[model samples]
Target: MGIEWAEPGSSGHVLEASMRPVDSLQHSRATPVRARMWKFSLPLRHPETGRLFADIDHLGAGLQRRSIDRYMWLIHDRDEGSAPHVQGALRLSNSRTSTQLSSILGLPSTALRPLRDRSGQHGAFERYCRYLLHESPEAQADGKFHYPDSAVHANFRFRDMIDRYFGLADSGCVPTAESADQIRLKVYNGDMTPLEVHGRHPMIFIRNHKSIEELYYKGRHDRLIAAALAERAALKDEDARVPSTDPHAA
Candidate 1:
């Protein structure tokens, strides 16, 4: 499940009304109830400037790490005839705690602020939210973007190393064999590039990269090769102990 940032209801200024006895209109036996409506604007503006604010990337990251739901306002635009609109408007620049926003805006505990004006486009905030939750880390680390083609080549080499170390058909690991075969076929046929493979199988790619780094980073290939041989033998023994359900099983 994912986080739900918006709520359902009518949009724009939320009107809260209450009724109390009218003092002037009260008689001993007859009293009139006076209804009063308070229009509370959504605190979708900068507290100091009362202007629309948007710092999408920061807000996205902050939302993931922070628990200040009270501090954040739902971005909304009101249509006179429609239900309250809460969709893609950007949030305030400051990702402060709800208490802070409330204190700064002098807002009542029950009121919420929606963005008075939109930041030109809808869905941008949503996209940013997704990106922050998913791709922002890799993007920040210069993992995928920096290498461009290097990661693909690196992944290909890693797959080749694994296949060489533990022969696909001989190895007891069926899933690993299937994944390796897919990589081999794609790399050889030019149907998939290294980067594309990484995208499809990121966990495998990262694990392979780390494995390769352990093996070759300090020029310890012979030791790693010996370890792989021992692992392969162990797998072969494990495979032999299991009764073959299929006569064709390797």
Candidate 2:
């Protein structure tokens, strides 16, 4: 779905302030145009009941996880639409047993030494048994999904993602016209060139099992490295612009 614009003090206005991504917002507060947009993956469909469910959930309190169960549709872009990249869209799914549980639960920052190590570790079956037997009566009585560990983990990840995704190179500073122009040039240069015509229907193309695996492992790593490099460049530029107060400033 495209971005939803909300008026200040309107019924759905709560999210508008945080979702803004454009510099023009400050100059014209009364404008109705959207300053930013977020891309959300299309829903996963069920074959039995023909119901659709979102693949990703952005539950506000730092908890974001792919749906535990859903069917994903793979479409092939044989017509060169996905040129620079070999694929169209890939859906990420998360399982309850995934090893990422601990970080998600905020165990790393907890003050309790004993419980910190156990929250998100692979010894889930053991942990569950331990909680059932040794945990305080109040914690044991709470539901599994809403338990203190799970709640803390979700909030931790949510806040971290917000900072990573929405934060600018410098805090409390709007982007300058020159910097905005540079960003536009990068967008134009870095993006995949558009195709003149739509490619083959996804059903017609055959799938390569090996390519998919390579994309997940090698391609994903390469993209992450590129993102790191971009962030480093931005930080370096920001550092260079600081005015030196002392002549001997290093």
lDDT of 2 at 176: 29
> All candidates' lDDT scores?
0.36, 0.27
Highest lDDT scorer? 1
Cα distance off (Å), candidate 1, residue 203: 13
- Deviation (Å) of 197 in candidate 2: 21
Per-residue CA lDDT of model 1 for 1-250, tens digit only, reads 0111122333323322223234213432443222111112233433334443333344434434223221222333333232332222224444433334334334432343333223664433333332222223354354422211121211123333333333322233323444545663555444555565456554444434443334333334455767899999999999989898998877
Give model 2's TM-score versus the native structure. Answer: 0.18
List RMSD in Å for every model shown: 21.3, 26.7
